[model samples]
Target: MVLRSSFFVASILLLTACGSGGSKNDSLPSETPEEKGESLYVLNCASCHGEDGKLGSSGAKDLSVSKLSDQQIEQIIRKGKNAMPAQEAVLETDENIKLVIEHVKTLKNKP
Candidate 1:
C-alpha cells in the first residue's frame, strides 16, 4: 500500500514539474532574416558556393570578390549564370531570395 501511494505521489510531482515550464514555442524568438537566409543558403547554395560564399564547387563564382549589386545578384539568382541553375523554382518567393541576398552580401571580403 505504501509503495503504491509513493508511486502515485511521484507521478503527480513529475507531471506538475513538466507542466511548469510553460509553452516552448512562445519562448523562442522568430527566425531573423539573416538566420533564415543562412539556413536557405546552406540548403541551396552552400554545396557549391560554400559557407563563406566562395567555394565555387562547379564553376560557381567566387562571391568574396563579387562586385554585383543587390539588383544584379537578384537577377543572377533568378536567371542563373554559367553552371548555376535558375533559382526561381528553388527560392520560390521574393522575400526568401531577398534574405539570401542580404546574407550573401555579408560574405564579401571588404576592401
Candidate 2:
C-alpha cells in the first residue's frame, strides 16, 4: 500500500510539473521598446504596410512619406480609413496601438 501511495504521489508531482510550464510569452526575453513595437507591427501591420511601411498593398498608404500627426495616425489606426479595416479589435489595446505607431514613425524616410 505504501508503494502504491508513493507511485500516486510521484505521478501527481510529474503532472504538476508539466502543467506549470507557463505561457509562451513567459519564456521569451523582455523586448526593448523598438523591438516590441516592430514586432507588433510586423505581426499585425506588415502584410499591408510592408516592413518599411512603403509597400502600399491593397490601397494601403505609404507610411514612409506620411505627414499625419501622431494623433491622426492613432485615430486612423483605431478607426481605420477607406480600404483599411479598424485595428482596435486586432491590436487589442491602446498600448499596442501606440507601439505600432512608434514603429511606423521609425519607417519614415529621412530628408
Candidate 3:
C-alpha cells in the first residue's frame, strides 16, 4: 500500500511539473525583418553555408568573397548555378529567398 501510494504521488508531481512549463509552441515569433532573415538562413542555409556562411563545403564557393549581388543570389536560387540545383520549387516563397539573400550579406569580410 505504501509503495503504490508513493508511486501515485510521484506521478502526480511529475505531471504537474511538466504542465507548468507551458505548451511546446509557447515561444514568441520573430518581430523584425533581420530576425526573420536569420531564422530563414539557419533553417535553409546552415548545413552547407555553415554558421558564418563562409565555410565552403563540397566545392561550394565561399560566400564572403563571391561578387554575386542580391539579384544574382535570387537568380541562382530560382534557376540554380552549376553545382546547386534550382531551388524554385524548394524555396517557392519569395520572402524566404529574400531573407536568405539579406542574411548572406552579413557574411562579408570578417575584418
Candidate 4:
C-alpha cells in the first residue's frame, strides 16, 4: 500500500513537472524580426502618430512624405525628434531599430 501511494505521488509530481499550464504568452512561438518590429512600433508610436503615421499629432511628421533615409530615421529614433521621445531602450539594439525602420517604410506605401 505504501509503495502504491508513493508511486501515485511521484506520478502527480511528474505530470505537473512535465506541463506548466502557464500563461498563454509562454506557449507562443518567438516573433520574427519583422513581426517584432511591427509590434514595437505599434506599442511605441501608433497612438499619437496614427496607424498610417500621418496624424501629425504633437508635431509628428507625415512619414509617407518623409525624405529621411534609414540612417537618419534611426538617429531620430535613437535620439528623439521634438515631441517624440528617444527610443534607445525600447529598441534595445541596432538590429531592432533597423527592423522597425523597414516597417515604417512600408507605412509610406500603405494607405
Candidate 5:
C-alpha cells in the first residue's frame, strides 16, 4: 500500500511538473504591429533617438518634434539621412518600415 501511494504521488508530481494543467496555448500572445514596431525601434533606433524619441544623441534629430510626412520619413529610413544610416537593410521590409512609422508618430509631443 505504501509503495502504491508513493507511486501515485510521484506520477501526479511528474504530470504537474510537465505542465499538465497549463493552458493549451503556452506561447505568449503575438505582439501587435505597434508593439513590434516599438520593439524594433528600441533595438535599432532608441540608442540615439531615445525611448520617447527626444534624446537626439549623435546628431540624431528630436523625433518628438519631427514634422516630416510619412513618405518623407519612409524615404529617409530607406535611404539614409545626414547622420542616420540607411535602414533598408536593417528594417528588411516595407511592412516593418510602416510599423516603425506608426510607432514614431506616437512620439510626437502633445500640444
Candidate 6:
C-alpha cells in the first residue's frame, strides 16, 4: 500500500511538472533594441514586408524612404492601418517597437 501511494505521488508530480508551460520557447528573444527589432521583424514582418522591409506584397506600401517619421511609423505599426494587422501586442515592448521603427529607417531607397 505504501509503495503504491509513493508511486502515485511521484506520477502526480511528474505529470504536473510536465504539463507546466515552463519552456523557454515563449520567453522574449532579445532585450537590446537592435536585437529585439530584428527578432520581432524577422518573425512577424518578413513574410509580406520582406527581409529588407521595402518589398511589400503587391498593394502594401514600400517602407523605404517613407515620408512618415519614426514616431508615425511606430504608431502605425502599433495601431496598424488598412490591411495591416495591429502589432502593439505582438511587438510587446515600447522600446522594442521604437527599435523596429529605427531598423525600418535603415531600409534606404533603392538606386
Prediction-by-prediction clash tally = 0, 0, 0, 0, 0, 0
Off by over 4 Å in 4: 1-27
Q: Mind giving the per-residue lDDT tens digits that candidate 2 earns over 53-103?
A: 988999999999999999999999999999999998999988888988998
Q: What is the TM-score (0 to 1) of candidate 2? A: 0.71
In order, what lDDT does every prediction score? 0.89, 0.89, 0.77, 0.85, 0.90, 0.78
Give the best candidate by lDDT: 5
TM-score of each: 0.74, 0.71, 0.65, 0.68, 0.75, 0.63
Per residue, candidate 1 scores C-alpha lDDT tens digits across 1-111 of 999999999999988887766656477778988899989988999999988887889999988889999999999999998899999789999999999899889888543
8: Cα error in model 5, Å: 35
Pairs with steric clashes in candidate 6 = none
lDDT per residue as tens, model 3, 52-71: 87766766677777788889
Candidate 6 C-alpha lDDT tens digits along 25-95: 66765467777677778888777788787678845677765789877888789998898888999888887
Give the per-residue Cα lDDT of candidate 2 at 106. 85
| Candidate 1: regions farther than 4 A off | 1-25, 109-111
Distance from true location, Cα of 4 in model 1, Å: 47
Q: Which segments of candidate 6 are over 4 A away from where they belong? A: 1-32, 109-111
Candidate 2 backbone collisions, by pair: none
- Among these predicted structures, which one has the highest TM-score? 5
Give per-residue CA lDDT, model 4, range 4-108, as digits (tens). Answer: 999999999987876765545487788988888888888888876777888888889988778888889998999997889998887888888888899899888
- Candidate 3: residue pairs that collide: none
In lDDT terms, how accurate is model 2?
0.89
